[model samples]
Every structure is written in structure tokens, then in C-alpha cells.
Target: MAHLPHGRKLNFAAGPSALPLDVLQKAQSEMLNFNGTGISVMEMSHRSADFTEILTQAINNLQDLLDIPSNYKVLFVQGGGTGQFAAVAMNLMRLKPNHSADYFVTGTWSQKAAKEAEKYGKVNYVLPHTKQFKGVPHVNHWNLDNDASYIYYCANETVHGVEFQEPPSHNPDIPIVADMSSNILSKELDISKYGVIYFGAQKNVGPAGVTVVIIREDLLGRAMPSTPAVLDYKILAANNSLYNTPPCYGIYMCGLVFEWLKTHGGIETTAEKSNLKSSALYDIIDNSNEFYHCAVDKEHRSRMNVTFRIGGSNGNENLEKKFLEEAQNLHMIQLKGHRSVGGIRASLYNAVPVEHALKLADFMKDFQRRFGEPEA
Candidate 1:
């Protein structure tokens, strides 16, 4: 609830989102003399002992935070989540080289993941494709492929604001790969249920350069012959995420964030705060008498990203524009929705405080009162 540094604005961008102010200050303090190495983390050699300590400490903190099982290996790689889309297919498809992977597309990211996988091997849709992604279908209705190499899904869809509250029920023999790009560390998870979980750090973790991949040991070493060494999970794991330079600075920043999360009572406390934050915004939208609308189903609404409109279901462009302008005037930025969805999106990443969400909620209520049609 402490005020942000002077001139700092509340940020709600979908990715490349907010980093905790504490993390930023710590980074700034170490910028010139990281551990007295006399070089910035950006300048340190990945092979140097100082940098090795940073990397190892980072991995340990992340493992502790997630309680990552001993059977899984965490790799920090490049290319964001989009890169992993291909890596997931190339690595896992070869698990059952003759079979396909089942994709349950609930939103834009999952849809893109499925499409990218097709370049490597057959991708079967578990649910019939729909024009709009508003909510997840019942598991019973899903057309799952029991023989699939893996079952893929996105934990949270940034664009549609739909999220899977829990991993889908699937055959134990088939692995489950999840793109948790936008929602990792927001809550406690049963890590054992997943085969591979990958996330681009820019969302809730840290900066844009590093992508974290946590894959079960058995799933590694399965990349197709044509797979690039960089994108190959087995190669990255074997090298300890240093097969190449890796994202040293970004990974360092992620380490700080992880420590911040741990010091702030870890994932359990973070999840409680996240639920309160999203609920504050959703309550405003729900009580707005149709002045505001959220297309996603109530149960599937994302705790990380809340997407809605200023007007009715279709939205009122002028009023929405005015809302953004006013919010900017008040130092709240990046509330615009994705261009494809065309509305408003308020990303409540872990670094974002619940106080900010309440501030936005107050703004929404005031905006509605001033511009909304009077109820008779």
C-alpha cells in the first residue's frame, strides 16, 4: 500500500508487465557492483563464479517457491512462450512419434500453441473450435485422444481473460503440457500433475528476455531430430540453462522477484491477494448495470487479467477511449484491451498490489456514475 516512486504510474499491460518496486530498487543498487564483482549482471560472464552463484541461487529459489518436484528440471531459455510452442511439439510429439497431441484451445494463446505445434506433428483438437473463446467447455464434453503424446492447454488466456481453475482431467499415461505464460506463481499448484509447464517471464515473473520451462525428467531428451539445440529441452537442461549465454540480467531480475514473493509470505499469500484484487474489479463490472461487461464466464474469469468493456457487450468506443484517457490522466496506464478483442484489459500481475486494483475500481464506479444511463 506504500506509494510508488514519484511519477510512477500503475501499469496493467498484458506482458512485459509490472515488476515489483522492491525488485527494481534492488536491481538498481546492484547494477554497478553485483556481489562486488565490479560488473553489472548484464556484463558478467555466464561462466563466472559470481554469475554461476546467481543462476544457481535463482534456480533454488524458484524450486523452493514452487516446491518443484525432484523429477522436474527448470530451464531458462529465450524466445518467450511462442518459442516453447514449437519446442513443446517437437520434444513431446516424438514421445509417440506415430501419434498426435491433443490441444484444448480455450483462448488466443492456446489456439496459437496448437497452430504452432502443427508444423512439427499432428495436433488434434480436444474441443471443437469456436469463433469466440469465452469459457472452457466441460471436461466430459472434450474429445480427448487417449493415445496422445501429451495434452496441451493454456493455464490462463491473456487475451480472452479465461482461465482454467485446475488442470484438465486426463489419462495418466499421457503427459500434460501447460502454457502458464500469464499466471505462473499466482497460486499454489500440484506440480506432479503436469509433464511440462512453461511461462514467459515478462508477465508475472520478471523481464522479457527469459522464459522458464519446468519439464519432468522423463519428458526431456525427446526433441525431434530436426529440433534446434536452443529450443530443445533436453539440451537446455543438460547445460543447466547455459547452453548459450542465457538471459543473465533477466534471470537475475527473476531471482529477485522470486525472493520478493518468498519474503512476502510465498504463493499462498500471493494467491489470496490475487483473488482479492480480481474480485474487486469483477465486482465493479458485475454491479455496473450493463454499463460494463465482461464476456468471459464468471467461473472462468482470470485472476491475472481482467478484460471487459465500458459499454455493453459490444462496447462503446468513445466512452472507452475517454476512460483510458482519464485513467492515464490519473497515472493509470495500459488498460486497453488487445486489438483483436477491442475493449479494456486490466492485467493484475503478481507485482501489482491489491490497493491499485481498488483504485481502479473506484475510478470505474465514478466513470459509470458520470457517463452511464440513469436506471429508472
Candidate 2:
């Protein structure tokens, strides 16, 4: 196997996370002429038999990895996760027009989802953040509208580094929709618990431009009057996501990723690996002894992304800058925090090898010994 160029750093970006090395090489080999067709996948017509086989393989691979039930339909569409926020509201708000929908606001993304839904129908924000957006509030404290149409939440709040360790139990009759953008396919999930699950492909799945939607079959064709034909689940599902020429290349890449995951022992093994990487990083943070602090609550911390800040009397700006500079010098790129929060973040996605996390942890310990005050 060809190796990466010397001195190339490990990437820790939250979105557009690192892809498997083999997948990239496979794409490179197929870029000029796929299967002797003398054409790139990007140039193939959506209706061509080659592209049709590619789409079918993509869907089949996804279904196999997730073990999706026959009752669910997977649609690969053009919009990103943000577009699904509006699409979900449009298709699923078909209950009696005046009824409200419940939203569990764990962080910024859920809040945005609620705001979009409000334009389509009544929206009730539930489980508000009271303790600095640290974790999901206790379910009993939620003020759910008994007559609401559905309940929505973002399973992994990538920006705040919060994740729901357990699924929420809301009105049983109402469907539960989720945005699993950053954490999808990293672990196993009970698909039956959700009426709809949507994710952007830029994170763990594949590349940008494709959004995967897995919806229960019963929920199709109930779109609101104002819903566009393209956004309607019924139309997309019926046409097998080929309505208006889907993002073919993105879907093909996703298939390659799914195959890679299967060869690596599927979601269970992936979750085990992810747990080890996260534990290694978090152990460093927790043991730093006032030198580093993680903002998210321990129970709700995300395994996919770890956010932390250095300790000091003043803000830790100087230490953060030093860490970034040192990390760059050490060939570690994109370890900076998200703009919404001004602290360091390490996103340990499935594609990031365990050795990468170990190296990062070692760097953190060395940096602390050099810069942090000695314990008295």
C-alpha cells in the first residue's frame, strides 16, 4: 500500500473529517476511468447503468452496515443536514394544523431545528439548557405538549461536544426525529426508536453535498401543503432518490466508506475503537489537575469530539495559542476549537487511528509539563 507523504499531519476537523486512506486510494485509481468505462463517476449520467449500479451498491451497503429494517427507506438527497431541518418540518408536520411539535433543545443545532419548525407549525421548546449547555436535561423536567405532533432532537451536538448517552422517551404516539450528523455510523443505534434519522455526509459518512435520510415507511406522503415536491419524502422515496439527479458521486463515495467500515469489523468494533480513543484523550484532560478543563458534563461528553481548555487565573488565551502553535510545529493540524466556543477541540472520528490519539495525548502531557505550574 502506498503511504502518505512524509510530514503530513493528522487532521481533526469536526466536519469533513478524515476519510479512510484506502478509500482515497481507491478513488484515485478509479478517478480517470471507472471499471474501464473510460469516464469518471462524476461524468456518468444519473440514468446510466453504471451509475445505477453505483447507487444500488451504496444503498445496499448502508442498509447492511446499519441493519436497516425493510420498513424503512433510505434516500440520498442533495441538501446538507441544515436543509433537512426544513425538510423534516415540511413533511412530518401533517398533524392537525394547529398542533405544536416538541423540541428537546440540548444545544445550538436543536435550537436551530426548533426555529425552522416554527415556520411550518407550532413549536414548543423542551428541556431548555439551564446549566451552561453542559448536558441533556432530565426527561421528567421536560414540559412536553401532550398533543404535539412529534419530538425532535440533535443526538450529537457537535458544537457543544454534548451527546445523549441514552435515547429519550417522549409521547409514544408521536414520532421521534433526530439529526445524527457528526456521530452517525460510529456506533450502533436502535433505528426503531426513531421515526426519522438524517445526517450530512461531510462528517463520518463520506463527502459533502449528500444528505442521508432514513424514514419509516409509514411516515411518507404526509407532507404539508406548502412542501416542495423535491422536499417531499414520498416523491424522493418513490424515485429512489433519483428525483432531479441526486448527488451521484457523493453517494458512490459513501458506498466505499461503508465497505471500509464492514471490513474493519462494522459498527461494534468501530464503537469500541472510538471509546478507547476518547478515553485516552479524556483521561489526559481529567487528570491534568486544574491545568485543563472540559466544558461538557462528564456523562454527556461526546466520544466523537472532545473539547477542553487550559486553566489559569485569566482566560486561557495564551495557553491555547501556545498549544496551537506547538501542535502545528508537531504536524498536528486543525486542532483549533469551533468559533462558537473558544477552546481547543479534538475530533477523534472513526477514520482517525488510535495511534493518532495516543500521539495527541502524549503531546498534551509534554506540553503541560513544560508550561503548567508544578504541583506543590
lDDT of 2 by residue, 1-376 (tens): 1233643568888988888888988999999999999999999999999999999988898899899999999999877988998999899876646657889888878888888888988888888655467887676788888787788989888887999876787778889999998898888998988899999999888999999999999999889878888899999999999888888889989999999999999999999999999999899888888688887889999998898888642238989999999988777878888888778889988888898888889999999999888889
- On residues 1-376, what C-alpha lDDT tens digit does candidate 1 reach at each position? 3346766889999989999999998999999988877889999999989888988999999999999999999999999999999999988997885659999999888999999999988899999779899998887779988778999999999998999999998899999999999999999998999999999999999999899999999988888899899998889999999999899999999999999999999999999999999999999999999899999999999999999987899999999999999998888999999999899999999999988999999999999999999999
Highest lDDT model number: 1
Candidate 1 structure lDDT: 0.92
lDDT of each: 0.92, 0.87
Model 2, runs deviating above 4 Å: 1-7, 129-131, 312-315
